[model samples]
Target: MANNIFEKSITDSLINRVNQLTPTTPNQWGKMNVAQMLAHCNVTYEMTYENKHPKPNAFVKFMLKLFAKSTVVGSKPYKKNGQTAPQFIVKDAKDFGVEKERLVQYLKKTQELGEKHFHNRESHSFGRLTKEEWSAMFHKHLEHHLRQFGV
Candidate 1:
């Protein structure tokens, strides 16, 4: 089974991995620097908690649900250097300290909200999802990127 992001232990473990990183940490694959990667990861939470990105139109949302939902919320790991969603592409430099703190806070907020808050939650892109789907999506993406930076 996948790690549950709603669990404090798992959330702490993920934060520890984030704490292990430094600004100069090298990626084993992919184009993003450590700070950029951190910012990119934060985009997921931004979509959930903030009104930063525009919600997709009906057709695009439908397509995302049909095609991308499984790959995103499923247990399988992401491929290295895979295509990133447009909203997640971080092109400019980000402050390492700022991005790291934001990521940690987002993780903590998610954990504090707990599984009940996320059960049948409507995702910004993938529409409604169960707690397990939300957990898998959050855990998998963080793990994949942390592994990318060799943390």
Candidate 2:
């Protein structure tokens, strides 16, 4: 796995990748535009640090625990056009700039907090996570979406 995938440098890399994408950038898979992809990437962080969304029900948590957690936190890369949590589905159009800035800010905050802050932290649905698990969740999700947009 890549090192410090949640660090400021990683965030900067993501910012650079995202910046390289124009509004006209085409996707390699799925139906999202670059803006929507950015928005989709933001949802993971949103689920972590914000109270905007409710926690999944017990059954949903069971489903994620039994089925999704391994794939999400494993070393293997996600399959293209993979399934996602429902909260992550972005149906509305997004502004590339707006989502870009928001994602940057979120990344900055996460980096500033450092791995110690997130190590074994309580996740909304997955319960406690090791730093590597957290990193996997963060890095893999972004890479998956970026690949989707052909970045």
Candidate 3:
């Protein structure tokens, strides 16, 4: 079975990865600085948990469903320095500590909610997803960025 966010072990691993990051940490690749990276990472969960960003219109959502759904929910890992969604881009500087703490909280909350909680959850862009899809979207994204920073 694939490692997933619903598993406590996987969640711990992700937390550890985040913990390894510091304000001074430099990216192995990608344009965002450490603070921006952390903020960028939080955007995923924010999309899931908060309504901070507006949902894509029907046409845009359909486009994302066709073009981006597979990359996000598939088992295949993300390529380094891939293009980010407009909402995911962190344009300004962020506070590393604040972003890190928020991300950790989001991870823990998701883990506590568990796979059953995520089954058929409505995604911000790609519509409804199964627990596995949710896990893949959450885990792979964090893993990709963490790996990008050489954590």
TM-score for each model: 0.99, 0.92, 0.97
lDDT tens digits by residue: candidate 2, 45-69: 8889899889988898888888989
Candidate 2 local accuracy as lDDT?
Answer: 0.84
Q: Which is the leading candidate under TM-score?
A: 1
Query: What tens-digit string does per-residue lDDT give for candidate 1 at 1-151?
Result: 4699999999999999999999999999999999999999999999999999999999999999999999999988999989878999999989999999999999999999999999998999999999999999999999999999998
Task: In model 2, state the lDDT of residue 146.
Answer: 79
Backbone clashes in model 3 = 0
* lDDT for 140 (candidate 1): 97
* RMSD to truth, every model: 0.6, 1.5, 0.8
In Å, residue 56's CA in model 2 sits off its true spot by 1.3
Best of the two (1, 3) by lDDT: 1
What's the C-alpha lDDT at position 28 in model 3?
Answer: 95
Cα error of candidate 1 at position 60, Å: 0.2
lDDT of 2 at 117: 95
Q: Could you arrange the candidates by TM-score from highest to lowest?
A: 1, 3, 2
